[model samples]
Structures are given as C-alpha cells and as structure tokens.
Target: MTAPLSRYERVARKVQADGRVPALSVALHRADREPWAFTVGESGNAAHPLGPETRFRIGSVTKTFTAVLVMQARDEGLIDLDKPVSAYLDVPAHGDATLRRLLSHTAGYQREPYGDVWDTLITPDAAKLVAELDRAERVLPNARRFHYSNLGLAVLGQLVAKVRGGTWEQVLDEYVLTPLGLRATTVTTPRQAAIGYVVDAYSDAARPEPPIELAGVAPAAQLWSTASDMAKWAAFLASPERIDPDGRVLAAATLDEMRWPLTTTDETLWGAGFGLGLILVPEGRRVVHVGHDGAMPGFLAGVYGRRGGEGNPGALGCAVLGSSGGAGQINELVHELLRLAVELDPAEIRPWRIAPPAPTAYRSVLGRWWSEGSEFVFAWHDGRLEARLADAPADRPPAVFAPLPDRPDVLRTVSGRETGELLRLTRDDSGEVVRMHWATYRFRRFQDGFDGGPASAGPEPVPAG
Candidate 1:
C-alpha cells in the first residue's frame, strides 16, 4: 500500500461505515505523469475487485462529450451554434428554439421524453425515438429557464446525425473515440462491462441492477468507459495540448468557448457557471475544469481536468468510477481527492498570481468629473483609475482605467481594446479647469462661461470597412 493509500483507506473505511455504498474506483493524473488508480470493495458481485480497467456507465456525463462533438462540427463550419435545430434536423420547433438554446438546456422541453422511466436494459432506436416528438412539442412556455430535458438532448443527437451524415453512435465512434484513441470507450454495449448495482434504501444492501441501456437518448447518457480511459479524457479537458490527438476532435478556441459560462443553474454550486457540457469549480484560488458526474442504474462516475495546456507546470486531472447507484457521495469523494492533489503539491496547481501594482505619480487625475446630462466619478485604487457610471445597471460594475503610453492627458479603459484621450484642460484667468477635451468630445466643467456640457451622445466614430 502507498502512503496516499493509507490516507485514502481511511476515507474508504469511513464510507463503508456509513453503509451508503459498497464499492468505489478512482484515477488521478498530472501533466507528463502516469495516473494513480485506487479501488475499494467489490465493484458489483462482491467477488470481483474493481481495477483501473473496470468500465462503468457515465450517465449525464456523456453530455459533455456530445457537446464537445457539436463544438467540433461548429469549428469545422459544418454547423452553426446560432442556427435553429430544425435547420439541421427535420424536427418541428413549436417556438423559436435554436441549437444554442438546446445545447444550454434552455429549450424549455419537458424534462423527460416518456412520462415514466423506461427500462435501461431495453431502449428504442433513433427512428422509434423520434416518433415520440409529438409529446415533446408541449414544452414549457418560457424558454429561458434552465430546465434540463433528455428529449432536448435527443434532438441534438438527431441534429448531429443529420449534419454528420451518419448515426449519432457512428459520429461518436469516428470523430471522438477513434481520434482520441479511446478504443475501449463506446456508446454501444461492451463485451466485458461492469454490471450496475443499486443499494437497497431499506436494507442497506447492494444488488445488481440491469444495465441502463440508452439507445434513444444515447447522446444524453449511453457513454461507458474505464477509469484509465476517463483519466485520458479528463487530462485532455485539463491540458488541451496532451490529448487533442489529430486536432480534429475540437479546436482549442472552441474548447475554450465550451468552458465559457453560457448560463448558471441551481442544480450545482461551483463557479461562474456551466459551459457547453462541463461543470466549472472554484478549486482553491483558481478555477479548474472539474469533470461531469454520472449516475446510472448501477454505476456512478466523475472526472475533472486543469484549464490549460499540460505544459503549464501544475496542470492536474482525475477520474473516478464505481459500481454503485448513489453517485452524490462519489462525486464528493472526487472533489476531496482534487483538494488533496493540490494541497500535496501546491506548485503543481498553484493559483495565478497578479503582478504587483506599479507607482503612478498622477494622483491629481483622480476626481469626480461632471458635464451636463452626465455625471461620473473617477477614483484611484491599486495604482489604476476606476470609473463608475452613476446611472448604469445595478449588476454592472465600475470600469478600470490605465495611463496612456507617453501621454499624460489620456487614460485608457483597462477592459477595452481602444484608448481615450483627455486632450486639454481649459482654464480661465482664475486658473480653474472650466472646460476639457476628451477624445473628440468637448466637456465644460459646469461653470457659467463654458460651452454646453458634453457633446451630443451619438454613436462613437467608426472606421470604414
């Protein structure tokens, strides 16, 4: 047993003592380093020991992979995120539902396609699945709410098939699994797969449950993989350079966009918000790409990665799979492992540090400036000037400014790409700044003998194309 195992063993013993689960599997990886795998208890039958190679159903976690493929199609110009799903697939859209809305779970579709849960061991094919669309059309009225819908994801699968000119399973096999060298990963049934099991709520005992087959909603939850392969997938998400095998799976920019928050939901409390498919977590001082969690009839899993290239000194990632139905506990365990990984080696996952503030001698430039029809305040903080619009929205924060290069009369918006100039500070015999020129607009200090306040608020001058 390894020293880390001694620590992990204590955790496993505590889990067993709670009697919530009977088995667990975990895998950890860092850039340019081999992954660490651990298992406790019998995975399914109490006779077979779970190992790094053990496969498990990755429920909703499959959505992250599917989202990645959609991003790939978008990057290749084969599909547009803004386009309507009906544009690609012949699906009927009762309202103005677009692919972006569907991807972000804002389509307002019913939570589930069928009113009741279907047997996972027996699922319908794509064509048979589409026949149920009539019922799916009666989704909620307000499409902006974050309502997770399995039917909405099924529609996304249909779109992928239509755009890629193949079935969703075929697209996953050809574009994602094959390119990433995930030979053991697939949307279809495997020859040697781990049987799912659910813990008895009353007895606190475990029993094997039939595999939750998802032929119709495969895009939403049919993926299956071992901890080892999932480690590679997590590493790819954390360190983009390490696992983008042929550069065809997903572009770096598109991947970055996928990590960007499209919306925030109440289901998870982690970070800025949910992106295309992955969950964002505030780990320590920096945000990290925490993998999605999966829960099937008898299986549960979790995966996570760093936010940049593997070359980044401390990039780290991990994957965990188990043959238990209660995934919430396993998810918490993965987070604990992540915390330990960073704490054990701070240098490997250190938070980004901002550079120290520089000295600025222009302290007089900071003050409240008022013009007719407009009143704004400027203050200096951390060696930078900040501007606050008195009448702006409550959620919008103040804007920061930096000094213009080789120009004392100009200040640039710290968050903007362009610079603004403070041309001249007009003065009278009394030596008071009665008027000033900013950019091309003129501003009067609000004293009696000055021109009108600021110029008319028209569109800023734009360069000709």
Candidate 2:
C-alpha cells in the first residue's frame, strides 16, 4: 500500500469491521498524479486477501462512462439527445420519449428490464432487450420527476450502439477505457473474472455467485473494474485537462452542457438528465458525479468525482470497489473519504461577498415593478425585497433580491446565483415615479402608461446611486 492508502485503508477497515462488507478495495487520485489503491479482506473463499488488481463488478458506475460516450457521440453529431430512441433503434417505447428523458430517468420505463430476466442469471442480448421494450410500462409523464430506471439506461446503451455501429461494450472499450488506459476494466465473463459473494442474510457464511454477464443491459450495470482503473476514471471527471485522451471523448463545452442542470430536482440540486452517461449532483458552487454499478449475489460498487473548480482546488476524487452486496455502505465510505481529502487540501477561496452598499439619497427607486413573462410578484420577503414567480409551480421556489455592496440602487437575486441591477427611478412631467430601467427592460409603476413595449435597443446602463 502507498502512503495515501493509509487514510483510505482506515475507511476500508471501518467498513469491514462494521460487518457491512466482507471484502473491499478503494482508490484515490489527484490531478496530474499517479493513483493510489488499497484493499482489505479476502475473496469469497477467504483463501486470499483482496488487492488493487482484483476486479469487482461495478454496477451503476458504468452509467457515468456510458453517459460520456453518448455525449461524445453527440459532440460528433452522430446522435441527437432530443430525438427519440426509436429514431435509432428498430423498436419503439411507450411514447415519443427522447434520449434526454431516458438519461434523466424521466422516460418512466419500468425500473428494471421489463421482466423476470434478472431473477435468473440469464440476461437478454440487445435484440431481445429491445423486443421487451414494447411491454415496458410508463409510470410517469416524460420529464416529470426523478425516477431511477435501469431499463432507461439499457435503452440508452442500445441507442449508443445503434448510432456508433457496434455493441455497447465495444463502444465503451474503444471510447473510454482505451483512452484512459484502464487495463483492468471490462464487461468480463466468469471464466476470467473475480467470483462475487453474498453474505447469507440468515447466517455468517459467504456464498459465492456467478459473475454478472450483462450483454443486453451492459450499459446499465455490467462493468467490471478495479480500484486503480476507477481512480483514473474519477480523475478525468475531477480535472478533465489531466486526462482528455486526444480530446476525442468529450469537448469541454459539451461536457459543460452535460453538467448544466436542465431542470431542478430540488432547491439546491440540479442535473443535466443525461450527459456523457453520468448522474450529476450539483453542490452549490461545485458538482459531483455519483456513479452506480452492481448486481445481486456477487458485487456492488460506486465511484464519485466532485466537480473541480471553485471549491475543489486539486480536483480530488475517490473510487470504492466492494465485492459484498452493500452498495449503500460503499457509497457512504467514498463520501467520507472525499470529505477528508477536501479538508486536507482545501481549494482556494473565492469571496462572493461584496462591500456594503451605500445609503441611497433617492427613495423613489423602491416601488412595485411588474416583471415581463414572469408570474412572480415583486414584493418584500424577510425584510428584503424579492420576486416570487407566481406562475412558478408549487414545487418551484421564488427568487429573492438584496442590495449589493456600495450599490444601493442595484439588487441581485439573493436566493439563487442570478445577478441583476435595479435601475434608478425617473419621474415624468406628471411627477409620478413612472419608469425604472433594468437589464435592458424598462418597467413602469403599476399601470402608468406601461404599454409593455420593447425598451431601447442600446445596452442598458449599470445602476448608479
């Protein structure tokens, strides 16, 4: 074990001692540095201890990699995210659901492949898998809610294969693993793979299970990888510059498009739905990718990479590979590891606070102004003026505004990151506080000749007290 392994080993031991998992491996990588790997516990038979080279079936973590390939294809104009999967595949799904919906789990397909195929070790091939799509049940409208569906990703994989003209496994190998130099990563079979084990719920015995062979749903959860390989994969996400692999996988702009939130799942959380095969978790100033991969009876794994920039200085990331079926536990361990790494190497602080705004000589600027094409009614909230989008659905929160430092006439969105200036109020010949200009839009108080007309074409001036 390397020096870095000491901290990770402590985490692995805690997991093993807690009896959550029998054997586990962890890897960590910093930008522009060699990856470190650590392992604990023995294989199913307890005959040998686990090592960095030991491969575990990474369940949903494969989705992140798959998402990348899809985004790469999109960058090359080989596939369109807005188009329906039926546009590429020979089979059709419930509605005109597009690939974007499928990536975000909004497609409403049944949680798993449409059947009892997973109960037995028998998995369907791409053709057989597509045939089952006809019977797939749509639970919710497209883009309704965050519903995780394995079938959705399986469909995405099929679409990638169709667009790229090869198997899902082949596409991943050629596009991602080969470029990243992941030697121990693949969709492996039992003959040349680590045997998975499950702790008998009723007993302390560890029962061996066959390797999960997911030819049809390979894009969903069929990836097999070691901690070392995953560490490199994590680094690529943390700091793209360190491992872009000839810039063929995904352009920075396209990757940013993937990271941008198409819709808000929660107040503080947003996701792109699907971009380059990864599930994005937005953490205020930064973003993180929580990848999933696993199967019953044998293995469960998770890989997460915190979004680089802003708060993440070195762009740190960690990978957890555990053979026991405790997927949730593995996820927790990785989170803890990341917390420690960030504390140890804190990112440079960027102060968002501005100097206090000066007291304004004019009080005319304070008044009700109607926002165009917005349901939000501008009013005061918690001692500060705000605009609550009235048309904003019950789930959508309102935007708040507060005075900026040294600029009393300008108000920015305090609740979210949106910044805008509050234009000074001007009175017409009638001596009424009529017009207020902001962000190129002129606002008239209430109904004072406010024709809802377009403002001047020239750039709007900055707010001055």
Candidate 3:
C-alpha cells in the first residue's frame, strides 16, 4: 500500500465527516510505541482547525480525578472509604452512607444537590449546597443500587479540600495533575480550548452552548483537557507502575483497587459496572477496558485503557474529545480505537526458551499430551507449569498451574479456567506419567491409550480389570 490511512486518521475522518461534531480529536497510546493522534474539523469556527492540543470540557471525567484524590486520602489514612462523609464533613442525614458507597454511586444520595441551579445555569456556594443536603431524599437504601450521585462526589471534593487545608483545585494540582505532568489539563477552559456547541438534531445548524461554571459541584463535572493530555491519563490508568514508577502520585496496587467493580445496576448488563472510582468494562470477557466518560452541555469526552488479562498484559489506551455534545459518536469511536489497536498491534509474545532443569518429579509430566481427542501442551513457562489447548484461538492464553509444595504430582490452576481446581498426575507401574485428573476429568497422554481410542502407534493400552 502506497499511503494507508492510519487507525487514528480513519477514526478522526469518520468523526468529522459525520457532521454531528464541529470539532473532534483522538489519540491512541500503546506501551511499545509512541502515541498516534489525528484531528479534523474546526475548534471554534469554520477556519480554525482542531488540533491535538485543543482542549474540550471533559464533564464527568472530572469525577475520576476526584475519585483518585479520595483514594489517596484513604491510602494516607486521612479518610476511610467505609466511614460516613458526615464523619469527615458537614452533612446531616445519610451519615450511614459510607465513602465507598458514595464513590461507587451506591450511597442512595440524590443525583444532584438540592437546587434550581441547573435550570439557572448556576451552581450554588459550598455553604448553600451543604445547607440543602437535608432536602436530598434517599431514593434507595444505602449501598443498594447504582444511582449516580453528583452531590456525593461534590461532598468528596469538599472532603479533599477540608483534609488538605486547600481548595480542591489546589489539592488536585498537587496530588494528581502536576505529579502526572498533565500540564494542559485545567479546571477552567484554557484560551486554546474549543468552544462547545450543540448541533440541531433536525438540521445541520448548530448553536453555541453557554459556559457553565460549576462552583461547589466542580468535582463532578468541571474540567477541560486535550486528547493529548488525556492520553497520558489513560496510560496511567492502564499501567500506573510504568507511568508513576516512584509512587509520587498513586501506587499501582491502589490503582488496581480502583478497577475492582464495587457494584452493578443489572445482572444482564455484565459489560458495565462501577468500580471504586474507575469503570470496569468486560468486552465479552475477552478484554476488560477500565476508564471513564464525560459529557457537558456541548462537549463529550472519553478515556479508556486496557486492563489486560488472560496473557494480554500490554498497556493500550485511547482518548477522544469532541466540541459537540449529544452526538453519541465519541463514545463509540473511542471504543473502536481500543479494540482495533488490540487486534492489529498486540504486544509481542515473549519468545519461548528452554527452562532450567525441572525437579525430578516435574520432568516426567511436562510435554505434549492429549485430552478428549484435543492436543494439549504442558510446559514450564516463566517458572510455572502452563497448560494450553494446542488448537486454542490466538486470543486465548494457557491455563497456569502452580505445583503443590508437599506433593510433586499435584498442581493448582491459579489464573484461568478451573481456577483453584487441583490437578493430580497419575503414574503407571514403571513411574511414567499415565494420565492426569483435573476437576475429576481424566487427561491422558498421546501414548497413554489416547483415552482408549483407536490403537496408537506407541504402546498398547492395558485393559481395565
């Protein structure tokens, strides 16, 4: 191909040509390569082209930053996620609603604080917002369901500000943005930021959306960032160890805790769930992407990064920003970007090499075998006995088993199907591996009767008595 359109370029072109968004920019980051980015359409008007640095309101994605601060406070013993917000700040009812409940949107708090501010396009002062908390009715029992509470996150912002003895914005800069080198991300729209617009649903015309300043609710939906800056944030979410390295911002383990799903709204929707602060997404159990999405009056933004499992440990991420809201394309576009990246540019598989001499007991069973007419491979990889279906799809990784210390012929599945199940190897009279039992199912080697199939070229099966 002479000049193939890159994945980013193709997505950006599709986003722009859709004509729903006035401006769009997207970026993709993989651990092994530099980030790829593309932009199309105008930032403010028909002439100015949207670029990688063009900032857009990242609405509720601000909540993820706010949640990180809450988690940091928890790690420092400043706040307990299991304790009540009233234990930390001035709130009357819902004292039974724990910080964990609030963070995960299970606190049963009203979605918004008591106010006509949304209609007025104005947010109330902290004092007024707190004074109205008594009016926030609990629609559901505490920790019962996934009811998103903007007020709950605002209360968290207040907790951060109160604990740090600084404004929430200051604490955010000191604890997250500055530490992460997200220089362009800001609480207020920067001069280079694109102006938000709402495209008419019925016509091609669009109207400018008024700038809304979220005073007390800033933590819930008030931040502006570019795709470039957000790509860094996504990378950090995917693998904080590589990004932070020194734990200056947050530890890798703490980040992992954030990805653990706290609750889900429905049983049928396994793809969506709420974590401590991040989002837990299982893309058909093949891959799980963790991140957040944001939407304001006229802007939409999304940032998702792969939380790899099943032998896919590489870090990959995508960030999408659009100046037009209600188009619903940014979310889809960001997801496609991640899926394509994983499909086309997966991490290089570690080359297989001979392992050091295994213990005398393990040497006998570590090799190719057959189970249920399917070829299975058992080899020592990275110091563990890994078993894989030889004809397994490329996307599927092997089942890893850790040998039992007391018994050499026994192993336990640690990180795949039949996890925690014991694998007991059986030996013949001559001490050669005859077959293995896993989850009460027999697995025999190719030479071991082939599970009593047609006669093998190797040895004849000893008939059962």
Candidate 4:
C-alpha cells in the first residue's frame, strides 16, 4: 500500500510525470533533522512501485568520490596537485598537464577511450586501456576551458589504486563511504534497484537500457546508491565537519579546496562553474552550492548542498535519482528543492562575541588610517591584525597580516591583495607609530582637514594625540 503523501512526495510525483521517467526518487536533508524522502512510479518491466530503498546508478557522481581519494593521497604527501600525473602514473605522455588539471577536466584529455566503447558497452582493462593511451590525444591545450573528460578521472582512479596498494573500490570504502555510514552505496548494482531506460523522444514509450559494466573506467561513472544512503551522503557533503567531527574521512579545509572554482563551464553563465570534480552553482551573491551531477546510459543523479563560506554552518542538501536517461529534468528538480529548502528556513547567524584582548604591542596599531586619501581601518580579530578600506562591504574579507616571529613590528600579509608582502611599521623617536609602508603604499593616521592627498614617498608627520 502507498504511504500518505508528504510535501516532498508531491514534488517527486510532479518531477517523475514531467520528466516522463519510469521511476524517480528524491531526498532532502537538513542539519539536526531526519531526511525526508519520496519515490514514485515503477521499476523495470514488472511495474513494481519504486521506493526510497531502490538503488540506481549514480554515474559520474562517482568522480566526486574518486576526487576525495586523490585529496586524501595529497594529504598523506603521496601526490602533488601541481605536478604532472605522469610523475606518479605509467600513462602515455600527457605533455605538462598537472594532476589539478585532470581533476578539473581542464587537462584536455580525450573524452573516452578509442573505438566504440560507448556503443559496444565495453571498456578496456588496465593493460588494454594503457596501451591505447597513445591514441588519447588532447582536444585542446591544458586549462583552455571547462571540458568534460571521463578518461582523466579513470587515470586518477589508477593513481589511487597504486598509492593505497588496494583496489579503487576498497580504498574508497576504507577512506570515505564506510566513514560516512553510506551502506547502500556500492560499486555494483544491488538486487533491489531501479531498471534504467531511455524514454522515446517523440512518444511516451520507453526502452530498457542494457546495463554496461565499467571495467577500467569505473571511477568515471559506476556506482549505484539508494536515496536513503544518498541522504546521508548529502548531509555529509553539506557540512563534513559537523558530520565527521573526527576528520577521519577528509579535513574541513581540504573539502573547501575541492569547492574552489577551477573554471567555468560557460563564460556567459557565470553562475555555473566547475571545481575539482565538483560543480558550482551560485544561488545569490552570498550562497554557493558545491556538488556533482551524474548520468550514464539510462540513469541520472544529482547531489547539491549549500556551502556557507563565512563561519556560517550552512547545512542543507538535496539528492535526486531518476531511472531514465536524457530526461533533462534532474538538475531543474534539484535546484527547485534547494531553493525551497532555503526559503523555508535560512541558516542561523551566530551572535557576536568579544574576542580575547590583543597583545600590548599590537593594541597600538588598532583604529583608522588614511592611505592615498582613501580611508582605511586596522583592527584586531581573533588575535590577528586585519586591514581593509573603511568603505568596503561588511561581509568582504580584508587584508590580514601576521607579525614576523623574529621581528614583532614587521608584519607579513598572509591573505588578500597584498598577500606575501611585508609591512614595516615606522615609529617616531618616542616609539609612537607615525606611518607605515605596505608594499609600495604608505598609510598615515587620518586627521582633521588632512587633505595631504597621497604621498608617493615622504616622511609623514606623526598624528598629534
């Protein structure tokens, strides 16, 4: 018997009908709450009603899992993102394309192996795959643009296999899936799984798609998962630290690196971009989503979560699974649910609290100053010295500095436009700061009617107390 319809159930029904898919499932997750899931329509030729436990091939979403292993290898100092993959693997010469480029699909690798691998539903083994590397030519120069390449991820998988001394499947289970408690996500299709189909373009009829087993290229698109397990995965992606407090799976900062944009899919559409094995979807100026979409011969999947950049524990996610290929409605449905989640209840903003008092020496550096007639301010936050244009937006990051361990007065810009530059404080005979030089610009205390403008170079007067 069908269960009572929930809000999510209604949306899932609409999505299945609109996409003309044989079966569809959706899940929504939020922090500190149980996930809401719904499944509608039939599975395979049996007309069996689909349920939340029914697994479906997650396709290229597997790349994100492979990416996590690569990142873990990097954390262990076994791999370098800037170095060429050839330095670590025994693949054909790929010029100077780096590991970072491969993960971002900017390495310009051939989209697939030689011959009719896609049509034949056959992929080469490791030896056969490497032997054909010479035929895998670069379609464009490295970092030319956002190009999708399944071959690059397959190479990454091989690297993981080599470094861990285990199969890619085993390493993933040890490093990611097991740690996250995603029991239903497996490399092989489960017994209770949805049958993939290709819907006819001009009619309501559809044809079952023969399952293709990805041998060497399993890293590209070969994982099946249920909505119940995917909900847990989505929650982890939404906020890894909260979900994995022990950092057993991946470090919080490294996860942020994966979300950083490497390139844009379309130049005109700035809202859509690609990160390291992940997709970036901009909701507004403040909220950005980081996840991946997947599609194979007949299955489609999407997983997205809000990435709250600023100390905001932005925790919300949506996952969708469909049993039809080329439905072209998965992304739309996922986006709608994401928007709805945000609209219903926004992320909480923590209350402001006072930071520990600055050191006696650093206390003197706090307050407003003028640089080239432009107002600027230097203040202490969490024991660090940060400066920014006085008129800058409140939410924007500022140029932060750290005191040189050897020389307390000499500060180094750690982040922002002046990163890596030195800031030497100029003090008067009385040891009161008169002016300061950062890079090539000098800043002096702003005083009444001090229209001294910008001093290209000069010994500015110390502000009178």
Clash totals for all models, in order? 7, 21, 0, 0
C-alpha RMSD by candidate, in order: 9.9, 10.5, 6.1, 5.2
Of 3 and 4, the candidate ranking higher by lDDT: 3
lDDT of 2 by residue, 1-465 (tens): 545456667877888767557678888777634666777877554344467777787888878777888888888888889998777777755647788877777676778776676688677888988987778788888878767788888888888888888888888889888877887887874233456777777777877776557778888887778877787777676566656745766665565566554554453534433343555554444445544334555677767677643446554667887777744677677767766666554555666655444234334434456546332345443455555445554434455666678866556654532444444446767555566555556665443333565343345888998
lDDT of 1: 0.66
The candidate that wins on TM-score is 4
TM-score of each: 0.71, 0.71, 0.79, 0.86
Ranking of candidates on TM-score, top first: 4, 3, 1, 2
Cα lDDT of model 4 by residue, 14-127, tens digit: 888988988888887777456778788888845445777888999988998999899999999999999987787777667467889999999998899776888888998755
Model 4 scores worst on lDDT over the 10 consecutive residues at 1-10
Off by over 4 Å in 2: 1-5, 45-49, 190-192, 262-276, 282-290, 293-296, 308-311, 347-465
C-alpha lDDT of candidate 2 relative to the true structure: 0.67
Q: How close is candidate 3 to the true structure, as a TM-score?
A: 0.79
Tens digits of per-residue lDDT, candidate 3, 323-378, equal: 88887888888888787776666666878777677666677788887766677877
Pull out the clashing pairs in model 3: none
Write the number of the candidate with greater TM-score, choosing between 2 and 3: 3
